[model samples]
Target: MAVIPVAIAGAPYEVRIEAGLLARAGEHCRPFLRKNRVAIVTDENVAAEWQAPVTASFDAVGIASDWLILPPGESTKGWEQLARVVDWLLALEVERKDNIVALGGGVIGDLTGFAASMVKRGCGFIQIPTTLLAQVDSSVGGKTAINTPAGKNLVGAFHQPSLVLADPLALDTLPLRDTRAGYAEVVKYGLIDDAPFFEWCEANGAKLLAGDSAARETAIAKSVAAKARIVAADEKETAGIRALLNLGHTFGHALEAETGFSDRLLHGEGVALGMVLAARFSARQGLMSGQDAGRIVAHMEAVGLPSSLKALGLDCSGRRLSDHMLHDKKMDAGTLPFLLLRGIGETFLAKDVDLNEVAAFLDEELRG
Candidate 1:
C-alpha cells in the first residue's frame, strides 16, 4: 500500500492506494471510527460490486454500518438527491463524531461529503473512491458539491474527508469508457506542473489503461502526491496556487452543461476535450507553441479520449456553449478566470479573459 498524506490546516488526511484495499478499509479506518458505527452512502451501480466487500470489512472489525444507495449518474447530483441523503443520514441518527463512508465514485463522494458537512453542523466522512477519476482527483480535494440549475458544483462546500482509500482494484469493474474518462484527470496533474510526468504518461498511459497494476499504481500515487502538496499550500483555494488543478475544469464543466450533463459526455470526457481546448486556446493566444498544443491533443487522441469539440456532435451553438460557461463556479468578481497553459507543465489562471473572445473561439470550434 502507498500512503500519501494531505496536510490541510484544520483537517489533515491520508489517501491510501493499493490492490484489494477495499476489503481492509475498516482496518485503515479503525483509528477514525469514532462511534463504533459508520453510515455508508453509495450509488446503485456500485452497490453490487463494492458495497459487499466494504460492509464485510467493517463487520470483520466489529464496526456496524448501514447503507443508502442512490441512483448512479450525473443527474443524481442535485437538490433532490442531496435532500434524500441528508434525510437518510438523519434517519441513521448519525452523530457529529461518526464517519460517513462514501463508498463509490466522484458523485457519491461529493454528495456524501456535502451531507456530512451539513448534518449535525459537521460530521466526519471517509472517501472510498471506486473510479479512476475520483481517486486521482475529486477524492482528495475537500471540494464537495451538488450540481445546481445555475451550473455544475455551484452548490457545495470544502469539507475534507478524514480518510481516503483509493483501491485501484475497485477500478477493475469500470467500463473501458469510464477508465478512459478517468485517465483525463491523471493526465491533468502532469499538465498542471510536471512535464516529466507528462512524458512518462505519453510512454505508459496505454499500459496503465490496459490494466497494468504497476503502471496504475505509479500514476495514482504521483497524481495524489501532486494534489496533496498543492492542497497543503492552498486548502480553500483562497490562494491561486491550488487553482492550477482546474486546468481542464472550466472548459470541461461548460461542455458538461451543454450536454445536459448526460452520458453523451462524461465529466472526464468533457475534461479530456476541455484540456485540449485549453491548450489550443493558449496557442491561439500566442501563449504557447502550436507544437505543444498539437502534442497534447495527440496524446489524448492516442489514449481514446476526446480531443476536440467539433467531434463531440453537440446541438448547441458556440454562443449557446458560451452561455453555459458564464455559469461556471470559478467566476471571480464577475470575471471568469480561465486556466490556460503556456507549456505542457505550466498552467496559470488568466483572470482578464474576455468571454466575448471565448465565444468567438467557441464559434470557430463549432464551425469545425
Candidate 2:
C-alpha cells in the first residue's frame, strides 16, 4: 500500500493505492466511521460486481451502509440523479460529520461528492473508486460535479473526500474500453509535468490495461501523487496552477459537448483526442515541432485511444464545436485559457486564444 497526501488548505486527505483494499475497506475506514453507518452511492454496474465484497468488508467491521445504486452512464451525472442522491442521504439522516462512501466510477464519485457537499451544507465522503479514471483523477481531486443540459460538469462543487481507497484490483473487472479510457488520464499526468512518466506510459500502458498488477499500482501511485501535489498548491484553481491539470479538458469537453456527453465518446476518450489537439495546436502556433505532436498522437493510437478529431466521426462544423467552449467553466474575463503544449511534459495556459481562430482550426481538423 502507498499513501499519497493531498494537503488542501483547511482539509487534508490521503489517497491509498493498494491491491485487495476492497476486502479490508472497513479497517481503513474505521477511524472515520462516525455514525457506525455510511451512505454509499454507486451505479448499477459497479454494484453488480463489487457490492458484495464492499458490503462484506464494512459489515465485518460492524458498519452499516445505506446503498443507493443508479443506472450506470454519463447521463446519470445530472440534476435528476443529483436530486435522487440528496434525497436518499437526507432520508438516511446523514449528518454533516457523517461520511458518505462513493463506490463506483467517476460519475458515482462526482454525483455522490456533490450530494455530500450540499446535504446539510457539507458532509464528509470517502471514495472507493472502482474504475481507473476515477481512481487516478476524479476520486482524488476535490472537484465534484454533475452535468447539466447547459454543459458537462457545469453544475458541481469542490468537495474533497476525507479518504480515498483506490484498489487497483477493482480495475481488474473493468472492460477493455473503460480501462483504455482511464489510461488517457493516466497519460495526462505525464504530459502535464513529467516527460519520463509519459514515456513510461507509452511503454507500459498496454500491460497495465492487461491487468499487470505491478504496472497498475505504479501508475495509480504516480498519478495520485502528481494530482495531490497540484491540488494542494491550488485546490480551488484560483492561481491557475491547478489549471495545468486541465491539459486536455478544454478540447475534450468540447468533444463531449459535441457528442451530447453520451457513450459516443467517453470523457477520457475525448481527453485522448483533446490532448492530441492541444499538442497539434501548439505546433500550429510554432511553440513545438510537428514531429512532437505526431509523437503524442502516435502514442494514443498505439494505446487504442482516439487520437484525432477525424477519428470520432462527428458531423459538425469547427465553429459549431468551438461554440461549446463558450460554456466551459474555465472561461475567464471573456476569454478561455487553452492548455497547449510546448512539448510533451511542458503545458502552459494560453489566455490569448481567439475562439474565431480556434473555430478555423477545428474546421481544418474536420476537413482533415
- 1-368 per-residue lDDT for model 2 (tens digits): 89989998889988998999998988899899787887788899999998888889889999987789899999999999899999988998889998989999999999999999999999999999999999999998799999988898888889999999999989878899999999999999999989999999988988998899999999999999999999898999999899999998999999999998989999999999999989988899899889889989999999899987877788999999899999999988888999998888999888998888889999989888
In model 1, where do residues sit more than 4 Å from their true spots?
none
For each candidate, the alpha-carbon lDDT, in order, equals 0.91, 0.91
Q: TM-scores, in order shown? A: 0.98, 0.99
Which regions of candidate 2 deviate over 4 angstroms? none
The alpha-carbon deviation from the true structure for residue 100 of candidate 1, after best TM-score superposition, in angstroms, is 1.0
**Candidate 1 per-residue lDDT over residues 1-368, each given as its tens digit:** 89999989878989999998999988888888877788889999999897788888998898988889999998899999999999999998888888888988899999999999999999999999999999999999799999988889999999999999998988899999999999999999999999999999999999999999999999999999999999899988989999999888888998998888999999999999999999989999999999999999999999999987899888777778878888888777888889999999999999988888888898899778
> Given candidate 2, what's the lDDT at residue 243?
98
